[model samples]
Target: MKNIYILSIGKVYRKSNNLYFIDKDKNKRVIPIEGINAIYIMNKVSLTSNAIQMILNKGVPVHFFKEDSKIGTFYYLGSLLPKQKKPSGKVHIEQVKAYINVEKRSEIALEIVDAIRYNMIKVIEKYREVYDYTKTLRNLDVRKEFEQKMTDWKDATNVIRGIESNIWVIFYEALDKILKTYKLERRTRRPPKNEANTILSFSNALLYATVLNEIYKTHLDPTVGFLHEPYEKGRFSLVLDLAEPFKPIISCRILIWLINQGIVKPEYFKKDLMGVMLNENGKRVVIKEFESRIRETIKIKGKGRKSMLIFIRKQAYNLEKALVEDTKFKAFRLVY
Candidate 1:
């Protein structure tokens, strides 16, 4: 993924033939948009119409992130304009038909939830030796939830979310033992009240955005989802659904690794009227670490070993297979 990251307050415009990044200090940096997959605007960055046109002409998407959370995406006109956009092919059509049929939707939703549950259990079990999680592991009812079934999209979604909530509760509890500095009483969103919550939310948002980027490269529609309903507006519900199994297995591990490596300190966070958040330096550190984490290689069945980015794209392809060929979509499970 050839991604250009912009983190500072700057003005971006199209010069003679390249994109120029001019900082508040009037210092300019040239970024050739050639071979670039996406441009990530992480902070307050101004863009010119010509620059926008240049990006569209290159068929590159621009993703805007609010603070540390991803707000929305600006896909190229060719991607958004129905008349210009190509069909998603037969498999994607079948996937949409399944969405129209509630029974199939419920089945896929259950499979997604099942994958999420299995991964959560695997993550917790792997960390059991590192932390005394006997009580937490005993309280987790993975078997009962695995055997459970749902009737409709709403029911399946509710159960899936509820199970996910419980998993995080226990997962955070176990982490609190190792990461004593950043205490997570419970999972918090919007204004993350604590350092742990702030790190988790930011990195999780990155995970969501990465999934969306992969979906853009595939034939799958980012809006049409199973466990999550496709919102009429900008919400990428499919990314949210697919990102579930990955957040615990990837983002959580990266956060813990950062803490253990002393790369992240408590002073990196700040609290204001908006709530607790990573400072500028903190954002740089976390973003750097997150980027490195995605590039790290992992072993997979049949594919041998590959970087997490490729793994993500392959997972998206697996979903396409599941939708098109009526095959089971096996979510990634991190092996310790």
Candidate 2:
């Protein structure tokens, strides 16, 4: 199945049980809903209720985005039980209970942090083979302190957030050494300052929405989370929690596009009151590369040469299994 992206100003509506895209120039195109699993509306687009109904009937989620920032998602209410017909609320109950208990929450936090740490280190090693990352990162004891302080009454989420911040610091520092013209000083949202940050913000949002779509095909509720506080309107925090480990995969691709391949040119970006943003061409380049990267095959322990997208859904299903069976949840680590 493929993802249908409405990237231009258009109106997408259902016609005789099929979806079509009509651009401002009156150029009409038919999108076969049979092979499409999700729709991403990136720009100004009007959707008829008939289109929404058709998407829901097909059980395909519609993700709306304003540029790189995600606005909302529309999917069926009963999309949680991918394999079972009835809703089993047991997994959600276990997830919330684990969040309430400090020890349980700390353990979950450690699992996430460990995965992030391992992948962060791997990314550095993969890019900068000449540098000694272990010696360079020896002074930053964020993970060690994170593990020790997680059990305290202090919020476990905040502790994990702190370690996440440190990991980015080490990550960007190593990245600076690799890249020639671009440098990432700190992470930025809303408006990305530089080219690298611009690509990162845009691609990370893609990853977030992708993971949320995958989570919908599982028994777990996306609203309830362990590392992030579950907000009523912000039900995607759990997807954010699950997105931590897979970041290096996207980050590696972004670096390759920006510095190695030199494919992302200056004209691909634009500056406005919102700082710097990817133009249509830039977004197309990033999305094309990012999608290709996710589809690339990698070896899983038991599952041989699985695509990264398949691994993400498998990880989500594994989390659901952990919640239901009361077993340890392990995040996905890059095979390299």
lDDT of each: 0.71, 0.73
What TM-score would candidate 1 get against the native? Answer: 0.81
Stretches of candidate 2 exceeding 4 Å from the true structure: 15-18, 48-50, 68-85, 134-156, 231-235
Candidate 2 has what TM-score? 0.85
Residue range 129-171, candidate 1, lDDT tens digits: 5444545555556436634644554565566667666766666
Residues 1-336, candidate 2, lDDT per residue (tens digit)? Answer: 677777799998999979999999999999888877677777778878887778777777777766432221112122212234457587788888888887777677668777777777766765545266544654556557876876766676788777777776776777777666666666666567677777787778778777888887776788877777686463577888888888876755576456566777889988766567778888888888778877788887667888888888888888888877878888888754
Clashes of each: 0, 0
Q: Which 10 consecutive positions of candidate 2 have the poorest summed lDDT?
A: 72-81
